[model samples]
Target: MKITLLTVGKTEDAYLKDGIEKYVKRLKHYTKLELIDMPELKNTKALTQEQQKSKEAELIMKKVQPLDFLVLLDEKGAELTSTQFAAYIDKRQIGSTSHIIFVVGGPYGFDASVYQRANDKLSLSRMTFSHQMVRLFFVEQLYRAYTILKGEPYHHS
Candidate 1:
């Protein structure tokens, strides 16, 4: 199974880039992990929150493939332990999942249409995180899950 991380905006921090790169290299050992960066909505200060989400949603939806399993990373979504996440990955592979896409929406969150398209929702933390930070956290968690699955020393119980 392949995992694709779709998130809005670019990760500008050098530290975050380095950290994400580390996990991306590690995740390659287990499954194909691709990162898709959605461009930020331009001049959105004039638009209302809802309008901004609607505009961003259009861009996000363009990246969605009919066969991809859309999973939104939202604070309101189900939270899972690292082990459980690894199990989730194993289950998807067993079920012959072609693509698993985890999306991090823009600041105001996803539109109703985006939510409707999602197969599942997952939360990295109950506490809020910036969309850019979520990319790093999610990639790191993916790496940790693989390490747990493979009995590697990277993840400590």
Candidate 2:
């Protein structure tokens, strides 16, 4: 199964961009992983938080295909251990999910439509992190999960 990570806006910080790139390269050894940066909405200074999310949601939905399983990275979603996350990926593979698309929403979070379209939601932590930072964190965790699945020393029990 292919794994795709969808995020809004670019990673402006050079350090964060470098870190995300490192993990993306490592993840290529395990699965077909793709990271897509959805363009930020223009003229957002005038739009409300809800309006911004709605506009972002439109771009997010466009990237999804009919067979893709949508998973939103949300604060209120399920929290799992590293091993559990690996098991989760195993389950998806067993179920023959074509593409597992994990989305990190914009600054104000996801719109109602985007939430409704999601098949599942996962939380990295209860505390909030910047959307750009989350991109790095998620990619690293995804790599760690694969290592755990392979019984490698990259992850410890």
Report, for every candidate in turn, its global Cα lDDT versus the true structure: 0.90, 0.94
- Tens digits of per-residue lDDT, candidate 1, 47-96, equal 99999999988998898899889999998899999999989887888896
For candidate 2, lDDT tens digit of each residue in 30-112?
Answer: 99999999888899999999999999999999999988999999997999998999999989988979899999999898999
Give me the runs in candidate 1 sitting further than 4 Å from their true place: none
Report the error of model 1 at residue 144, Å.
0.9
Q: On a 0 to 100 scale, what is the lDDT of residue 153 in model 2?
A: 97
State each model's C-alpha RMSD to the native: 1.0, 0.8
- Model 1 Cα displacement at 139 (Å)? 0.8
- Give all TM-scores, in the order shown: 0.96, 0.97
Top lDDT: which candidate number? 2
Collision pairs in model 1: none
